[model samples]
Target: MRIGILGTGNMADALATHWARAGHQVVVGGRDLAKARRLADRIGHRTGAGDLRTAAEHAEVALLAVPFGAAAALAGTLRDALAGRTLIDCTNPVGPGFRLLTAHGPSAAEQVAAAAPEALVVKAFNLCHENVWRMDPPVFDGRPLAVPLCTDHPAALALASHLTRDLGCTPLAAGPLGNAALLEATAALFITLWVGQHADAQAVAPPLSHAAGPA
Candidate 1:
């Protein structure tokens, strides 16, 4: 699949790298042309420029990897171009410095859908950190890392699962788009726990798990 990521941050770059390594064409777009070019060159895939519209316009699947607040802004900007396309949302709607902001209510995915009603918005990849995604995406224990996915479109959800598997993580369909609230809340919990671990200087979560227990 031709994957276009909307952010040039570590998360976007990590997905681009892994997707390119998996033999998929990946392109990155950001406010900084130089940064997008640099990441595209490093990934060794076809590169392009322009605003979010241009990036999302030409790709088969567009990954909304921008910051939480920025995601809705960018989606609003790309509203016309995103129609009829599958949008994989990886943003966490956290408050300042990754605090809970929008997870308790409608969730970031639903917000994106509301902002871009024509697009098929699916929630995925918000639970784990970018470092874990870049370095250790595979599960260490018996269970696969739980990357809960919620989407109303079956085709889009399947594509997300395929991409998740390609990137070395197991995908669990948490339900339809409305279930995004649960996933988003789970992401907040993960981030909170992550902060706690870093504060205590203990071992972080080895990988992700799809088990029934905690995040």
Candidate 2:
């Protein structure tokens, strides 16, 4: 797979590193060419560095690792280049107090889709911190982390699922793009519990066997 990462941040580094190590062609792009080059060097497998336009134009899948505030605008600019592409949105719109910044509007993923109408926008990788993703295989309590993705496009979802597996994680279909806000909200709540309360957010949900209703 040819993957384009549109950021020089932690998420971009962590995710791109995994993909590159998994034998995917990765292009790390950012506003600062030097930063992109540095990240590509750090990942150094089948990875390269380029301008944002070059990355988007050449990728089969594009990961929007930019900040939530900037993602929509960036997508708008890359609309043509991203057309008919699988665009993964890993952004969380959590603000101060761990509130969902997009509480009243469309989800960050939805906004990106609207901005790039021809792209297949998939919401994923927003629940955990970049450090968690940095973990080789991200397993805990003997279970690989399950990533819930929301996307209308089956092909995009399949591609995202394959990328998730590349990191040794599981991919769960969480519904269409319209349900992305729910995922974003879950991230906000989990982040609040993890950061503000020093709680293990994973412990909040019981295992499936225990979650079943009395029969």
After aligning candidate 1 to the native by TM-score, how far in Å is the CA of 63 from where it should be? Answer: 0.4
Indicate the worst ten consecutive residues by lDDT in candidate 2.
206-215
Residue 89 Cα positional deviation in candidate 2, in Å, after optimal superposition? 0.3
Task: List, residue by residue over 93-208, the lDDT tens digit for candidate 1.
Answer: 77766567874468788889999999989999887778778864557565556578899999898889999898778889989999888877766666666685544222434433
Clashing pairs in 2: none
lDDT of each residue in 15-62, candidate 2, tens digit only? 999999999989999999999999999999958999999899879999
Query: Per-prediction TM-score, please?
Result: 0.86, 0.98
Candidate 2: list runs displaced more than 4 Å.
none
After superposition, which runs of candidate 1 have C-alpha atoms over 4 Å from their true positions?
47-50, 197-215
Model 1 residue 51 distance off true place after TM-score fit, in angstroms: 3.7
Which residue pairs collide in model 1, if any?
95-99, 145-208, 145-209, 146-209
